[model samples]
Target: MSALTMPLAVRVIRAEHDALAAMLRTLPLLLAAQRLALVPPDFGALRAMLFYVDEFPERLHHKKESELLFPKLRALVPGLRGTLDDLEMDHAQGERAIRELQHSLLAWEQMGESRRDKFEQQLRVYSTRYLRHMKREETEILPHAVRHFSADDWAELDEAFGGHQDPLAPRAGQAVDEAYAPLRQRILAELPAPFGWGPALGA
Candidate 1:
């Protein structure tokens, strides 16, 4: 197949989707560690990861897709309104899922053993839901956007998506984004060499 000449927004969204999917895949490992009582779950690392999810994707990525990209795509593509609406609804549901997962994590951390199972269950559910949502957008919505959205539309969308700072999740003053900076360092320090943050393999 020929390579797609995709909009900048499409490329950025796809990269973010892959990264978040990797995090979702790692959650089960964390849960297993907690259950086996082997290498204890790094609650701090997990918390940082979850916070990053909330701040970046749930806050910034999905909002831009729903409010800006999706609307434009629906207008340009015939018979896309239903699919676009479904994706928008998924974004709303995903946000609620994240909030619930956050509460469960806090309870697990503070209340301890009693909340373990509940936290794990919520985490798994949220991961599954989010992964499914992202996959649908990747397979269905992104293709439609790439095919139908005008160059001018892509240009504007690309510029908005390519902002240096997250449009929705900015930090206080000149400080780094709370959810990303420390979390990234924590991931690098806490995770093993392969899993830790840093340059990708053979980079």
Candidate 2:
């Protein structure tokens, strides 16, 4: 659907999801290229990226999904209760998972190459699971919402989702927060062409 015609909340959700998915996809490539080139990982950049994921997707995006969107969906379509439950559970686990990832990243950064494989493995698993989770929501949950949600429901959701613009996916004419500027640059710098405007990693 055209952006102008789409519900504001749906637009916000899709944009945030795309931004997150791009970051998630770029991270493995960044790590692998660094490994292949025998370069030390950019620990600061990695930390920034992980912090963005935790701060935006895990905290902000999922908060809206679980507290507002999913509950509304469940109430409107009781048949969706099962899927919504599973998605909510994923949201709950995501906070803990990001914490574990942050810890693993710290360990790898401090403890040398011996800890690298473990962090990489955890990141791969986390990324894969999150991608799948987003796919389910887009395909299953969002379609239902688009069909079922009333004007009032859309207004409420739009107000909540629209209030917080993701730094990685700012709305038109909106500047990213100053606090996130460096983090945003780091991500764009590492993300390869086609996936992002930045230069390819290890190029």
Candidate 3:
């Protein structure tokens, strides 16, 4: 069969891979900031990254994988369904991890030392789990799912996220906020770290 006709499950997973790959590189950026203790810490920049964790992959990618992709995989291979269920659990846990990361970032920026220490420890621990989870997916799960997904599904997914408003798209009044006052200036000043600086972090 042609590429587009490949299983929908595979197509969607591949797209998820691409998106995850892009977002994963930001970990180092976060780590850099954590290490440097960059003054006037750009919490906005950090929040923008966290926003993607909640918004893009969680909302779009995981939704498709959990809802659309996994069901069919189970149908084709009965045993596979259990593993897919485990994956769903992983996604669910990821939300809590991101939430914790956000709390730590904000607290650290505000110079709450005890909270910062606690959060940093959690953040590193969570990062390890997240990376390990991704490895499991790429290595153990992707090959089987790929056999079922189609290129058409991948194309459609690509289009949907392509429409996602620019992550850098500030809140409606943000521009005006920057123009009018110092608070706005601080908020606007916290631009996203150079996530685009390196190679295409895609699979």
Per-candidate TM-score against the hidden true structure: 0.83, 0.95, 0.63
lDDT of 3 at 74: 76
- The CA lDDT of each predicted structure is 0.73, 0.89, 0.57
Q: Residue 202's C-alpha lDDT in candidate 3?
A: 33
The 10 consecutive residues of candidate 3 with the worst lDDT sum are 165-174
Please list all clashing residue pairs in model 3, or write none if there are none. 6-149, 6-150, 7-148, 7-149, 7-150, 8-149, 8-150, 10-149
Question: Please, what are the lDDT tens digits per residue for candidate 1 over residues 1-203?
Answer: 23356666776787677767776776676567547755456688778777778888988888888789888877788687888888888888877888888888888888987998898888888888888889989888888877777779888898888763442223235454565566667755644324555433333
Model 3, 90-182: lDDT tens digits are 888877778878877888778755565676577567656666666677666666666654666556545653443323333233242233343
Candidate 1: the clashing residue pairs are none
State how far residue 71 of model 3 sits from its true place (Å).
0.7
TM-score of 3: 0.63
Q: Tens-digit lDDT track for model 2 on 1-203?
A: 67689998998999998989988888888788879989788788788889999999998999989889998888889998888888889999999999999999999988989999999999999999999999999999999999999999999999999998688899999898888888888877766776766666655
Write the candidate numbers in order of decreasing TM-score: 2, 1, 3
Better of 1 and 2 by TM-score: 2
TM-score, model 1 to reference: 0.83
Clashes of 2: 0
Give stretches of model 2 more than 4 Å off: 201-203
Assess candidate 1 and give its lDDT: 0.73
Best by lDDT: 2
